[model samples]
Target chain A: MSLIESTATELLGQLQSGRTTAVEIAAACLKQIDRHDAKIKAFLRVDRDGALARAAEIDARRKAGKPVGRLGGLPVAVKDLLCTKGQRTTCGSRMLENFRPPYDATVIAKLRAADAVLIGRTNMDEFAMGGSNENSAFGLTHNPWDLTRIPGGSSGGAAASLAASMVPLSVGSDTGGSVRQPAGFCGVLGMKPTYGRVSRYGLVAFASSLDQIGPLGRSAEDIALLLEVIAGGDPLDSTSVDRPVPKYTESIARPLENLRIGLVREHFGEGLDAEVEAAVREATRVYQSLGATVSELSMPHGKYAVATYYIIAPCEASSNLARYDGAHYGHRTDEKAMAVELAAQRKALQQTGDSRKLEALDNPLIRMYRRTRAEGFGAEVKRRIMIGTYALSAGYYDAYYLKALKVRRLIRQDYDRAFEQVDLIAGPVAPTPAFEIGEKVDDPLAMYLLDLYTASANLAGIAGMSIPCGLSTGGLPIGLQLQAPPFEEERLLRAAHMFQQATDWHTRRPELS
Target chain B: MSISREEVEKVSLLGRLLLGPGELEKMTSQMGQILDYMHLLSEVDTENVEPMAHALDLTNVLRDDTPGVSLPRDEALAAAPHRDDECFLVPAVLGDP
Candidate 1:
């Protein structure tokens, strides 16, 4: 039987049956990347040698009858944001263009322990800032389905890599909709575990409270396999949940009878493309046929999700990214040498009684800090950082940041109430199918609104998954989202699997040629 | 309210991003649009709203002060762009003696 393009589970089964070797799988994937990446541009860096070496080691152990880890021999692509020991981990920014971490992130360590082959680092929006991969300083990662279109982002490269068969599974971080939106755009399975469900220790901080590392793959089962390996607690990440790891793979075969599905009315409201709505509605019918009852629920403040996320995420991001000055790691400038030049400018304004300039010397450290940040971060990242900085600034803290936090609590309460009445919340993952690359790039607010449907989960700190439900009229994939209460990832997986069992959407692949 | 190009430049400087002249103009326009959209938040009556931070209701799950493994000085600095004698070398801070 041909096994070159199977999912992670299918490949694992073949490995168990002695029909394939990890080296063979790794070589085939590397060959696919070599041929497809020129067109798709999914990977930022491909660790060909490292992948083969790891795959060979896995094969060697299997030959010696050694016990293997869960995802042993699976080729996995990692978003560049995660640290990989001795590997260039540029979070798609020129600032840390050549910075390599001396250690692996806790998730990477877990994947390594599971014997997964580290295939490569995929591109992302610089510092995971923009909604579209166009913000990547390296280059835009194209949608595998339609080369001229964007592969959703900031996990665009990760999603594109999987869509192109460059790798069967990849890791992505979702803060706001980084993972899910991209997965929806690329027509693949992407999941963001509960806020602390997966360790965020090695993920280069974007929005600390919102950032979550999760898997992207061709199918829900593949995501389950990867999540099983990556989920759990770690001392390195204080927020990581210290709960018993759920048997996600085992849940894949569970029955879906009497499941309660909540259709969030706010997500289906205006701005959602008719085609995307149809696709989700079709998936809902399939779930209903599987004996899951669907009901309409309301998250009235849902429209405020993106607005609230912009304030909270950027505020947290501004604080978290403060460590990246040239003094610590990544890019730095000779601010001290440039100080004389800066002071002159500051003094010129001071003499004019320009309160703006007069306030400058009050804190030269602020000047240096602002200069380093201004020079290092990207436009979108900077805008959010500034918004966050202003919100948390001495005068505006109680009004903006603090208020956003309170509204965020209300948003979380909204989700908590909905879950009590439903087994899972289901909706369209994005408002529309993948749009053209530059369609929303010029309009930042237009782009931010794209995460309206996906950002609520981050606000509520709940587990969410996006599965390919169907194709839009334009022939792009539409993602159907499913979410569950905290630590209920297994139920979320079971419900998604049930829907998958009734439809062939997950089995479809984008035209790569 | 229109956010001027000058304001965008000020914010950019505060955030540490070096934008080219063209990028600055683009960002100014984009940030102005985003800010306009964000103005809607002011309409929401959040006078008594409690801001949310951590997702779970779980309070600070702090561990007792305990000794933990520390990275070796050399190992930690192995990835430093420039290092010397157990210290990371950076551009000298001019004001510091």
Candidate 2:
């Protein structure tokens, strides 16, 4: 197999044995990206020179018999949402298109410390808003399995890069299933570590409470390896919990005997595609045969996850996005032109004796803010911002935002109750396999529903993962989700690792041109 | 609840976005549809349930009030679209200014 196609663990083995150099692996990955990225559109920026230099440094260290970090020489792709010092971290929006961070995000710093080669920044939904890669301001990332279909998002490019063998491992932020859903669509393993398990110091805020940085890779072990390096507390992020880091890589091989898996009663209901349901059900049966027990567990409030998420996520988004007003950084409107236009409008209204209209047009600063945001944000982003503003508006706060938060508590409570009866919950990651590129672009509700199975984990502050289960009738890949209680990523990884050992599903790659 | 064009425009202004006529119309209907779907939450009785702001029950996490290294002034202003040596440039806040 090509170096680009090898799993991170396999590549690490090759590097350790002196069979392959870091430079060779970096060159191979860059070559793969060069040859196929045009059709895949997975990357927003590829750091060719930087990656090669990093790899050469690793090779030199090894040649000099110096100690290198655990992930030395591994080429990894990062979602553009994570800030990398001196690298353009666009968050897949025109607002930050030319913006580069002054310093690395805590996770990026960890990756660098681990001696990993940061290969490139990947495409994502604008501000990590949409479930489909089509929401990306740059362009949609096509699924490597079926080029006409989306690779799932807002971590679409992260997953696509892995699926297309452009990178052995990639890091992505999961806010309402950004990482896992895309990983599901791309037929790879993705994890959303327990909220606050990984630092969010430089992750551009979407929904702060729901966001968590995680790993995407070809195998469960690879996911665990990356998670081990990046998962920890950072003083920089106040939300990052101060706890001892677990040896995730060391715990992956532990047997999962007597594991109690909860098959969430609501997940297999009306909206779930039959193939996805079957695949997940079969995955449960596999767990059962491995001396594990499966039981039907009811999370009564599970049905309300999507509804509650829509309100809470957008409400938080509005507050988080308020910073982009053409003042501090990002896209700025033509302030001089805006001022002149506002003056003209005020003068026109003054002549017409429309005092009300003139009063509204009086503030040139407000006008500049509006025009800048309108020009900077795309249609969906605008819609979300407006929805959020309305939800949190004076008259509607109790009815919308507060109500959703209460419902969010109920959702979290339901998961806590379900975990009492089971060690982990397994179900379909998304309603169906990968859908076509433009399938749900016009329908925001349909796109939001794509997050139905995944968002509750974020809401509950628990760890969740997606592993390749089976293929749809149309030959698209399906993913089975595994969720665990907060800070129980080791258990989640153990169960997934056990599953992968028994099934060859994760080993199945898309037939790419 | 049906979101009127007036409401959409109002919310857009609050969000600091200037939607065009077409965008205003589309957003009005889309917001109405989303709000209509959100009405499902009302069916559940949450009479005394405490609203959850954070998933983890964390109090205000404070470190010792100690000064540490901060971002260099030049690097911090590097990405600003409109900036001078010391501060970010913006349109006049007051009409007379």
Q: Count the backbone clashes (under 3 Å) in each candidate.
A: 14, 0
Q: Name the lDDT value of residue A446 in candidate 1.
A: 86
Which numbered prediction scores highest in lDDT against the true structure?
2
TM-score of chain A of 1: 0.95
- Residues B1-97, candidate 2: write the lDDT tens digits: 4788998888888888998898888888899999999999999899999999998878688889999998888888888888899888777675473
Per residue, candidate 2 scores C-alpha lDDT tens digits across A297-399 of 8888888899899988898899999999878778888877887787788778889999988667637778888888888888888878888899999999999
**Candidate 2: segments with Cα more than 4 A from true spot:** B95-97
Query: After TM-score superposition, what is the CA distance of residue A448 in candidate 2 from its true location, in Å?
Result: 0.7
> TM-scores for all candidates?
0.93, 0.98
Deviation of model 2 at A160, angstroms: 0.5
What would you estimate as the lDDT of candidate 1?
Answer: 0.83
lDDT of 2 at A187: 94
